[model samples]
Target: METLFGILNNCVYGILALLALWGAYCVILVWRRVGQVRFADEEDQDEFLSELEQALEMNNYGAVSELCEDDRRALPQLALYAVNNRNIGYAKLRRRVAERFQQDVLSDVEHRLSWVGTVIKSAPMIGLLGTVMGMMGAFANLSSGDKVDTVQMASDIQFALITTALGLAIAVPLVLSTASINIRIRKMEDLVGVGMSRLFEALKFAEA
Candidate 1:
């Protein structure tokens, strides 16, 4: 029984280790998002258009270089759609561009970030299971009609609390990360709106 509690303590250590890994992942998510949000912001879009202008004027590909530097994954292609369909009226061009982004790019960002929410919601349930099992262990050890080992009951209680703590540790930042992702998603959606506006205006000028 002594060796068993020791091993269970080690198991708790493993759970805590997983919690640490999740915390690290949240840090990574924030880091990656710093750049992504920059691109998503409509205010930050001038650099892309400026480069595209340079690309057109000098007949070089440096605008492509700027986008690649910022990890602006889909801007170049979307810009191309606007350029190519400039004569079609911006409305049509805008619709086509929105269809592509909604179907593939934005949807992909949403799907990838959704894991944060899933983990946050599930961790507490896992912790509840741990507490229930720990109670069962404590009751089983109470078999004797004489007296229960206070030390054993305390150990079980500790395990229950520790597991619950670890679960919340995993869950809290996951919720924060999901909120950050939602902000980025909205920013990107707004960028798409701006792109459609530009596409339409350019087409209207061409028609005139």
Candidate 2:
């Protein structure tokens, strides 16, 4: 429609829509880091769990710390509890300490990635609102007659079209970002599960 075309011509709305896409690039970088995050292999996880139990019963917090991969080691919660609470039962300590550990890792990686989903879902809707506002401007600009208010009408039409196009542009990438973020989250869950199970089991073995 002529109305739609005229609204998009001004291009101001389009520029704003384009900027919304920057969130997608940010998502991609975050996803890449999520992928880089380390997790123990399942068998290694089980073995480590077994060893961890041994270490705990032996009262060796240092060995427990050494068993953790580097990124995991950075989690202060991982070793701090065992080091601080020498009197705590090994099984209880394992449960509390490892749960905190998993939560910390999730917060660092997968939880942070969730913000991308929020941005992705919101950006397009923002663009759409801009489009609607633009269209309203178009209708308001016209005089009662078909003899148009040409100047204001063109500006209004540009805003409407650019915003709709921009909304779609932002949305497509946002959808992609959401998908990527979700995948990273799943990976984090899987990895953390292995680690936690091992940590708990190792403590159980130490008790037995």
lDDT, candidate 2, 48-135, per-residue tens? 5566667778867777666643434322235445445535877777677767755655565555455655666666676777677777
Q: How many residue pairs clash in each candidate?
A: 1, 10
Model 2: what TM-score? 0.63
Any idea what lDDT model 1 has? 0.63
Q: lDDT per model, in order?
A: 0.63, 0.60
10 residues in a row with least lDDT, candidate 2: 68-77
Query: Which candidate leads the pack in TM-score?
Result: 1
lDDT digits (tens) for residues 110-162 of candidate 1:
55556555567667767766676577667767865658888888877777787
Question: How accurate locally is residue 86 in candidate 2, as Cα lDDT from 0 to 100?
Answer: 39
My TM-score estimates for the predictions, one after another, are: 0.72, 0.63
